[model samples]
Target chain A: MFQSTGEIIDGVAKITLKGELDAAASGQFKDTIEKMAEQNPKKVVMFMEELDFMASSGLRVLIFAKQKMGAGVDIHLIGCQEPVLNSLEMSGFHHSVYLQETYSEV
Target chain B: MEALQLPATLDALGPIRDYVSEASKKAGLERKAAYNLKLAIDEIATNVILHGYEEAGLSGEIKISFEMNDEKIVLVLEDRGKPYDSRRHEDPSEADLELPLEERAIGGLGIFLALKGVDGFDYQSENGNNRNVFSMNRPN
Candidate 1:
């Protein structure tokens, strides 16, 4: 199961993702990213504390988010769990995004 | 030993993961090992679904069988839609890992990680089906 919601706050797109992030859910995540990109937000922050699993398809979306948003827009990941963090690290995605222990820490 | 036959689609990934997780645990794999096994299976299954079925425009099924002994566990995935060998990619060098993200190839990274995470991997094609085998050491 998967659930995600997005909102713009102070010109930054904040998307909260929960549940397992398998291939089936990646399309929805990419759609959220596209929707957020349309707002031209200066930054995109993903809240992933509740995310339990992340498949390769989910990592692919992170790549898509980077390409779609361009270099100027920063992407922050907050509160990544061990499994999801391990997936990011395995694919070398940890180097491409900023990881925060908490939203306020960023 | 146990087996599963699922459609070659994204929706089947979750159930596959669940089955692998349960089987790995039953085989005496620790948390980390079980997690790696699940991740490895996900990578290969994603490849099968994307390259095998969707890209080939042929719907098919992926058959998975798991067997465990005192020392190790083996997983075999059989697919009929297309032929792809994940072992074709060479192990990444340190310099390769240092490359800028945009400069790196978009695909194969997942397979690379999956290969590194497991104890053994093999691929073969026979009778119009691609068979991928993965093995991991069982925790003492």
Candidate 2:
């Protein structure tokens, strides 16, 4: 099962992701991204420490977020597990977003 | 050797991944190899469900089996959905991987990662069934 929660605080969108992000979960992830995009946050921070697995479909949603949020908004992925990191690196998506072990305001 | 059969649907992906994880453990694969195997199987299984079954307007079961030996562990997935040759698709070039977000396309990344994540990958079609074989060598 996949669960996600998001809230915008001080122009930063904080989202926490848990469980497997497979094809079925990508739609929900996209919905969360869409909602965050509507708020026009200057930065988007995703907490993925609890996220166990991610498939290609999940990567697509990350791509969607980058395009929807535009170049000015920085997306930060925090505490991603090794497997998840591997997925991002293999797809060359690591370069598109900021990966952090902990979230800190820039 | 062990096997499992599940309906070709998105909901089954979690269980399918669990099965691969268990098989990886049984084969005594290291962390990196185990994760790679899991990702490889997940990608092909997703394709079988989404493209081969859902897109083709067909419903079927995907049969997954694995065999372990001294040299390697081999996982095979068989589906009766649309026949597809994953090898037909090309891996993204270095330039493609380096493309900026605006220029990037999501298409074919799954298959590319699937093929690249494993030590060996093979695809075959026989009697209307598409078989995907993924293997990882055992550490000496």
Candidate 3:
């Protein structure tokens, strides 16, 4: 399942995703993103500290959000697990988004 | 032409993975490549479990056969429950990843993932059964 929580703080939107990002959990991620987009936040920080696994479907949704939300918004992926990060790199998604090693400084 | 027979069940995922991983390793597949093979097979098994035997209610079995010849690994996954063709792979829009979570479609990613993870993926539906053959060469 996808556990997504979003909040707007200091004009920035922070969305945290945990658990497996599989077919079953993509819907929750999509809904949370739509709600966050409605606020028009300047930047989006996705804290992926607890994310264990991610399928291509989940990654595709991120690509979709980047386009729909426009280029004005920057999405930062922080603390993604190794498997998920490797997947992103293999798919050439690491270039399109910003990845931070740790969320503590974000 | 002895055939390797296995029960078609999610329990088969482990043994199936083990058999593949060992064969790939013996063929000098790199650590990364072996991992990819495992990951790819896991995704296939997951699909079979979720979609193939959805009606089995957690009681279905999947038969997997491993055939290694000439530096290549051919994994034949036979499922009697449903007809799934793995060769009909369509690359989902790379643009969809950016959609807000609720707007994305979940139907195609696993197959894509498995396809990307494996080397040669083929499928044949016959005798009211679905058979998929995933082949990968030994990494140099």
lDDT of 1 by residue, A1-106 (tens): 9988899999999999999887789889999999999999999899999998887677778878888888678889999988778777766666778888888733
- Model 1 quality (TM-score): 0.92
iRMS of each prediction: 2.0, 1.2, 6.0
TM-score, one value per model: 0.92, 0.96, 0.63
Per candidate, the number of residue pairs that clash is 0, 0, 24
Provide the lDDT at A1 for model 2.
93
Alpha carbon lDDT of each predicted model: 0.84, 0.89, 0.72
Per-residue C-alpha lDDT of model 3 across residues B1-140, encoded as one tens digit per residue? 23345555544555666676777766777766776776677677767777777655544457767777777877787777677676576766667544444344535666766888878888888887778788889654
Model 1 CAPRI rating: medium
- Candidate 2 DockQ vs. native: 0.72
* Backbone clashes in model 2, listed as residue pairs: none
Q: Score the docking of each candidate (DockQ).
A: 0.49, 0.72, 0.14
What's the distance in Å from true for residue B86, model 1? 0.9
lDDT of 2 at B66: 90
The better candidate by lDDT, 1 or 3, is 1
Q: Per TM-score, what order, best first?
A: 2, 1, 3
Top candidate by lDDT: 2
* Runs off by more than 4 Å, candidate 1: B90-96, B99-105
Q: Which model is ahead, 2 or 3, in terms of TM-score?
A: 2
